[model samples]
Target: MLRDEKQYIESLRDGRVVYYRGDKVKDVTTHRALRAAVNHASLVYKWQADDDKRGLTVYKDPENGDVSSFFKIPRSSDDLIERFNLIYQTTRFGRGTFNIIKAIGSDAIFALMLVTRRIDSATGSKYAERVTRFYKNVIKNDPAIAVAQTDVKGDRLLRPSEQPDPDMYVRIVERRKDGIVVRGAKAHTTQGPVSNEIIVLPTRAMTEKDADYAVAFAVQANAPGLKMISKPERAAEAAMNDEWFVTGKENVETESITIFDDVFVPWDRVFLAGEWQFAGSLAVMFPTYHRFTAISYRAGIADMFIGLGKLLAEYNGVDDKSHIRRDVVELIKYKEMLRSTAISSAMMADLDTETGIVIPNKVLTNVGKLIANESYMDVVKHLVDIAGGLAATLPASSDFNNPEEKVYLEKYLIGKKGTNAVERARIISTVKEIISSFGALYTAAMLHAEGSIEASVLELYRSYDYKDSKKLAMYASGISEKL
Candidate 1:
């Protein structure tokens, strides 16, 4: 079912325990700090209801009527390409901020579908059946979801069970006949306060000794004993400004430290209980789907950067300068390079014969994500260079609003030939929001969001075809004679 914006907002009124700034939030949908995020997340529903964009956000499922395009599983390369378009366009719609409320949850669901099939095939378990049923319910209700995968490890060198504090990682503390009780916490649970459900996955591979920790399941965001302590909103002060672009609600996002204190998950909701061996497979498979989503959204953000650079350059009367043109071209190259990797990843996808699900090319996806992670700074550097020093030291909206200060700012801030002072200041304010205030978090997210730069580097080494390269080197160097 495709829920409209009002229905989506009302859904979060459930009695969930959420804290912000050490105070219990009475209503997330109406709270000052959280309302922007809720509104940002509701864009999915808004787009789905719009006749012009309905095709991009949703599709007719003969069995389920109209469902979100997010829940559609990819069976062929065309389907994967469609998935790419949905993600890319939605991020652009959100003003370069990807709404993970559905995109991320679906990424987890896709990974779960693929891994559970392998587990059931090897052990004759009915895990696959449970996942399908849960997936169907998600589609029918169109509930917003948040994925909680990163565990807060007390010590970097220790495993889940080996931690000085066992609760450092979320684990099954007790096994009841009807369900299992989970305890511990997940950090960086993006959009947790606004989501209806929270899907949990193992943060890393497990061993026989870590059987209790190798669990994957879904639970209500308001489940008994579950608590979400949310981080403060980013650029809160700037969002209050009267500037056009910087004040949009769609630019906000919220994350939380979600704690599960003896939370119970019924057997029906538990997808993996003690399958220690397949834990790593589930951990790795999720990022394969998620990194593709990452690169897609990053492409949209790149588009924004490209536009911002050009707009600022034109405002500063430097659009025709050769060096400025070169930098702009570099930004264009950065965007297209990330985009090409996404297209290549989809086109070179592999079909999982057992389940008939098409998996994006793993190596190419990582390569794309790596480029997005590493080259983001260069994107920022180029934008800052194009916009000049005003990006960092622009006068606040308050200054522009004061009649006494407005007179001076009006005359002094004017730019180029046709632009007014207020117009130039607004443009510079938008750039400030991106490059300095909220952009600090955004810059870090690009490097560490899906996984770290090191994580992608490690995956590339593990998955790339080094043996063929080695053989080619041997042939070229005449080392074959020794063999």
Candidate 2:
């Protein structure tokens, strides 16, 4: 695929209806709230054209024999491994900045490819053909895309059909001769404002009565009647890690409450329509692939935490301490755990053999994500612990740059005997920015990005191979003669 970074930026000037901070943003590419994410996305596109990652980022699509980014349907274990490598390599460029968030849209399409085929088998619908066409269009166009999988359900305990406010969940209100009209809202949609396209999917299982809600479609991000709202980054967030941090102005991840006010979707673009039974299929399948992406990209996150933690330890002159060394070791173990699980998930991937779609090993994908969610807080805790109070009480970057304040601040803040004040302050400043700027946002994202922690646990319980465990236990206790 051609990586048209400049074109991608210029295309954002289109009148995408985006509301942020009580006002409509004129242009997301230049808007303070979304510019960072735009640039972050640009890097991914740029990497596709750059010469640095020759075989890693660029690959020939085995199916079509065209060279493109590895974000495509994996036809085999090799393809899955390639996807993992590309994601890991790209992610390490930023601390999960242009991470799973951008690429999962394609994964959604791959999920849809398999699910629609299943639907075709069950109901004889030609939705799978439409999805295949859409996939081709996506690969050819090379557009930046975002996926909205979560709906703004009014009542947390109720299903979409049970909601008093039917519009709380995205649903088709009118099935026109030309297409369908949908109205509802999706909250916490990442990269909502600036993407070239938005792929919408049903959030959960649906019954026959919920057919209207069981719809999947793609629309132009600047489509009429579609609105996106994003919150502003804190001043502290942008001030630190200007280039690498997603919370920074030049590289941020955006989440918004996206509203579909009677947005019309043409029939050709509709991947799922009134297919209630298969709603859960898309819901399950999409996340399975997405979490695999999450697990792979998290390797980069672990690397960041490890590097920073070790640096903070060395800067603090506590590198020799037993506890500090132990913490660093813990960070390394966690990093390898994430990376190894991701690799295994790819290596042990499953195939919808006939469809040529490679699905991730559900157990490993979910387990990896679950472990990452569980341990993320502790990993950050170790980082914070090693950094000491300096991470908190550090002076602002502006103060350090000030001619008058530089000498006094730097002289007092020199961390170790050998390290200069500037070097010590610089290290602490970096730690300070990353932890403080994007701390809460990154924390919340790590907790619930792919899905909630409880949801991951449930998926693991439901998909895990428990038969072997049960048989082993039964034989050991003499509960059964043979497993």
Candidate 3:
């Protein structure tokens, strides 16, 4: 049941409660503030429906007909590598922005599928069956999903149950015969307002006392008591229309602070309830797949940066300069380093024997993500250097349009011989957009999104085989022989 863009757009008119700029959005699909993001999200469906892109975006399932490749669980390294290519190509299609509408949702589903199976095997619970049913429905309906995991913690030092305000973390406030009621808010929920569903997961490990917080479930985006307060789009309304890179809404992303004001989740939709022990496992498993997605998409974005830098050099008539060539090489190194790590992570995939799901190498995935997180600003720096002061000083497009100002801008803004002012301005505008306020939001996301830099560092340290490294060091130093 592959959905097209029209169906995906029509699904969002479901009376979801969404607020933006202090006003209740009448319809997210049409609201000025959110429509661009909605359109951006619709590309996931558009790609699936396009004849040329169909093969890359979806696969024909013998049992289910056409299913999104995102929903296909990776069974081997080849499957994982294919998934990487799908993400990379799609990110490039979006003009360097990764669509989270499906990528993130599928990440959560995969983690849920793997973790539930383990829990059910150990406890004889029916969680695995429930998750399977939910997953089947997801593939059948092809709904866009938004994952809400990061709680708006009130105090950093305190645990969930120890918080002065108990509702700081999403928790099961009441258990009913048919379902559970959840109350809390998750911050930085990407594309929540436009998504068809929201999947919730525990943010951290829990204890017996924190059992209530160890809850995971899915609810419709327009479910009763659910609310999404979206952050304003980073690009100004004027800029969206004026900037070459920002025009057409091709490269936009949105985030929301999703609120679950006692939202109800049916038992079938509840994957984890009061299972404090397994909460950490699910929390960790999600990032394992998501960071791999992150690095893959970042590689695509790095490719864009590399191209932008070369264009800047060519336009500046410095393409032959040794320093310019060196900078371009550095950008290539950054791009391929991330791309190669993603490939290695997939090639060194780990198989969950019980579930037959291929998991990306945890250490390599984290290492790649950490590199992306730490080095993104440097990528920006290199491009900014190549683009020159014109990247920042270029006049607004409106000024360029004015008859009085057009002549001066045209005569003064010309680049290398044979290149017109407009072309040079467009390239500089793109570089400016990448380092502008909009690009700042993207920069902050690189540091914080998909878990923080420290989170990846911790995961890499934890997943690495320290004992083996210690043994090798001991043998090299003759300590092993002494023993």
Candidate 4:
């Protein structure tokens, strides 16, 4: 029922209780450390309001007489591709905050998958009707929805049912005629406190004994008994605020752990309940959608890093240096490789699910994710190398006004013709923040998020067609007998 940027902001400001350390946070909406991220989310709404971005943010759905997010009911390959492009545009603006965009895309994709699955078959549930209407209302008003996927997971060594603490993963505590009361906690929830609604799901496949943990639903971010505890920011604004103007702004959003103390979810919002078999389907489907979005979104992030590296090369008067030029060229190679892999995944995509919505071949998409994971980090390292020592050694902006230090800074930090030493130093400092600082965290996240390096390698091993390749080798070599 939420609509508009102002309304979305107001929803987060009112009645939502968030914790940091131990005490309840009264106002995270404007807190400096958190404001950048909070504001970045708000801009998503503002984009819908704008004449330029509105085209990308909202779509007309024939199922309902309303506008909705592109992900709410992406029925065709074109619909899916547009969603990828839209996310990429937003992500390019905040390559520093593309992680938040990734989180948003992940939940949106899951929601669409659910809606599509429900609507396509006569035997399917009417959950899609409820979601379609919800999404329509959101688009007409432009509300923000966050997603919670991972569970707190008490013991990594044990399954959800085998864990010593039964409540570690969120599960149904009680089912009522009107609703169900959920008791447990969700972790790594991005934009948890500030969103209008949250789509919650089981982190992994569940066994028969884990049915209670297999439930999936959408609940208001501030639903009764729901409490969000925000994680600390990477570094305070003092380190990057001034530099943001000279460089790019940091997309500062927070992720958090959300505790549900017997929180009730009404029947209307509960999509999958007590359907343990569907839990694994949801788990596999959601990450494939997430990886699709990541393939393009992270490619855009690497593109930005490529730009910054070129800028730093020029600023350091090494634009003409052969080795520096080679470094810049290598960075481009990595960046382009990420783009090609992502685009190929899109081009080769086919409809694999019962739902009509086309999904990127998981094998190809995972390859894209793998290439992005490795190349993006190398891009960061190469950029740092080209940026040189000043990125790490530059003094704070506070030193700019000190009369004693100003003379020395002015004499030695100067670069080339037509640019003052002070200006070059400022530019170099900003570049340092991008390749180092929180920017480095974003680059690392590109590779590790969704799944880790080991996970991707394992998937590659599982997905390859080894038996077919073996058969082909035996036939071609005339060794018809089985090995």
Candidate 5:
């Protein structure tokens, strides 16, 4: 069953130690930096329950008659496509922004379930069973989860075990009769503050020397000794400028430095314990599934960029300008490119016999993500060109409230004869968000979101089958005979 907004909000009071700006926050539902995002997360829950969205967001489990979200284990290509639509709809709901913390949880669990069985094959371990049990626990509880990837490597020159400071990457510190205690931190944990669980996985492949670092587990977000030093991300907009700015996006997601201070993991919760061989599998599969989802959701953001760029050109009376038309066309081309690439990737997906989950095609998936990560900055560049510099010098929300300033500011700021002063102010304020530091930083994050550009290139290079191309070239050049 889908949890309501109220249930999700009230759950935040369960003693999660969340700190922001060097201060502790008792309840995220009411905190200044967290309230809006918490509410936004709540809408995800509410959307599942909404009658109009039920067909798209909620599904009936086949084995058990329980209500489930499309975020559950996808059994076939149809299920994967449903997830694609969910990504598009959710991004549209937030008006171009995608709070992807939930996507991380679902994608991780889906990939983990498959990879653990592979681990079982390589090593005679019951890791797959443990992961299955954990899967049932999460579905029954349906807790919001934040994935803790990317470790804070103190030195780029050293491996996890070779680090001068052993705690640089999260690793098992002590072994107990029943479980293990882990001590370390994970950086850039998106949506860490508002979540109910934190799923910890390896950041890289590990060797036997790095056995302690080759661990995977799930723990409560408010577990003993757990601390989240959070940095919230909020889209800035003038309070008096635009209703869309004020109402559409109030609270945004957060990323945090999550520290595990010798946190305990019970036997039931531990999925991988010192299984060094499977570390590489975990590293590759988790992000592969994540990148598959990234391309789908990011396309919607690209669409929003294109739509806004076109609107700005029209309002600025430059729609007829050759360059402005070309800019908007380029934006549209990128958005459609991402969308088509993702769909193509999904259409030719493969299924795992053990987990029965459909996986996106590797080459097209990487290409789609590469498109968004590589060109989003260019998307921003084109939007800025169309909107012009007024986005930065626009009057503040306060000026519109002052009677004397309101008359003069609106009169001068109004664009063309067709648009009004308030309309132009609202448009300018919206444009400000796209060109601001916050906007560019988010776009920049996409480059290294799933992995860096080099990583994606490597994956594409390895996954491609160039044997036929090479053969054709040899025959054409007379290097090989037809016989």
Candidate 6:
């Protein structure tokens, strides 16, 4: 486990593990776009070691009774609540670029708790104990880790075992007395290649026939036989080469696709295998935890945008304008709604089947995610409105370098009489970078990631407590309800 942020950055600097775009990246730490994101993530680890975030970021692991990072294991309902609060706090520090790092933390912490509880109940295995130990180590020594969840999904309609291309989903292809060999690729893995470690798990619920696909394990990012592919650089990549930081906003980090080419996993690291019955339970539990985390963390992101909107409105001398005021009001309401849902979910947490990992209630968890989806988009829309047309039409940060265009940029971009022309231009370019670059992509991901809004609604519909509510309604009306 990474002992501190220094090691985390060192790992990123120590590169070259078959990560490809069109060509392989020899070292991700120095790359123009990827480096900024890596530095951003390192801040999370660095915070754990700093005196300021110690209270929020550090927690005692119940198993080893050692103080670990709050991102490690959420064992009690209180543990879950504390973690829920931590993400909200961290959002202010990074302006929400740190959201995905916490997203990975949510999945790893909750899944370890859920699975450890289940295994402890079923076979009285030390799996839960081992997990707690691992978690404590990570917390004691903060690490930058990522979770791999999505499968290549060869044919959306076909199950993993039923797919003609068996490697479409990451699955166990061979088992030996000492370990297992896995093949296939996982897509949309948040910060997979740059992370210190990667937690691997089954992508979906599985049946008995799909036993080979129901596997879970954890490994170092540099583990042999693993390859990654990120979304190709945007058309904006060319522009970034010369001026990545000309805009105050950093270039967004890339999340790569990870392929396991018959990778060997040691027996000790393998947490689950062929537990087809619990496969659905695992899949369901992941979203419950992830959605709750998103509710709080993404709201933190909206909080950032709202603050930005207010600043921009004032700088532009439009804060007193009715439309801008109205937009700010709407934005604040959306942020408040997301905050409420996340807090409610955390407050309503419960214990699970085994390792005694406390999880948020399923119905509210799904609702939390839905609220995030709706609120995130609304906040962005409001920000866009308050920002006015300049949000779209601003010149690139590079234009400031030109002798001729610099004067026009200064004159035209001036926001208020008190502010210097250059400062106004800088702020406008930063806003554009926020709205146009990979950071923009992160906002879109908040809407669709961790399952779409439609999917969340379906989950809520299935878990609705309709029967009890219906019976109560009938009694209140003095009418006898029959089955």
TM-score of each: 0.97, 0.95, 0.97, 0.88, 0.95, 0.89
Best by TM-score: 3
lDDT string, candidate 5, 1-483, tens digits? 457778877888899998978899978788765776686777777777788877766677775455546456777777777778778778777667775757888888877888889988888888889988877777776678889978998898899999999999999999898999999999988888889988899988999999999988999989999999987444532322444455335536778899999999987788788989889888888988888888888887887887778777777788999999889988998888878877788788888887778888888888988888888788878888888888778767777878999989878877777877777677767778656635644765777887788888988998888988898899999999852
Q: What is the Cα-based lDDT of residue 394 in candidate 2?
A: 76
Q: Work out candidate 3's RMSD over C-alphas.
A: 1.5
Encode model 2's per-residue lDDT on 1-483: one tens digit a residue.
Answer: 455689879988998998878998888887765777787787777777777865566667766554456556688888888888888888887554544445878888889899988999999888888888887877777778899989988988988888998998999999999899999999888887878889999999999989999999999998899999886666324654343222375557778899999999999889889989999989999999989888888887788778888877886789999999988988898889988888899889998976988898999999899988999888887877888888888776667778999989877887667777766766666677667777778788889988989999999888988889999899999998897
Residue 456 shift from truth in candidate 2, angstroms:
0.9
Q: Which ranges in model 4 have alpha carbons more than 4 Å from their true place?
A: 1-4, 62-69, 99-130, 239-250, 352-354, 401-408, 420-423, 465-468, 480-483
- What lDDT does the true structure give each of the candidates? 0.89, 0.82, 0.89, 0.70, 0.80, 0.71
Candidate 3 residue 477 C-alpha distance from true site, Å? 1.3
Off by over 4 Å in 3: 236-248
Give the 10-residue window scoring lowest on summed lDDT in candidate 3. Answer: 243-252
Q: Per-residue lDDT tens digits of candidate 3, residues 260-338?
A: 9999899999999998999999999999999999999989889988988998899889989998888888889889989
lDDT of 6 by residue, 333-395 (tens): 877887777777767767664455677777777877887786666666788887777777876
- How does model 6 score by TM-score? 0.89
Worst 10 residues of 1 by lDDT: 241-250
Candidate that beats the other on lDDT, 1 or 4, i.e. the better one: 1
State candidate 1's TM-score: 0.97
Comparing 2 and 6 on lDDT, the stronger one: 2
Each prediction's RMSD to truth: 1.7, 2.0, 1.5, 3.4, 2.1, 3.1
In candidate 2, stretches whose alpha carbon ends up further than 4 angstroms from where it belongs are 62-67, 235-237, 240-247
Which segments of model 6 are wrong by more than 4 Å?
13-16, 59-68, 75-78, 123-126, 233-251, 401-404, 476-483
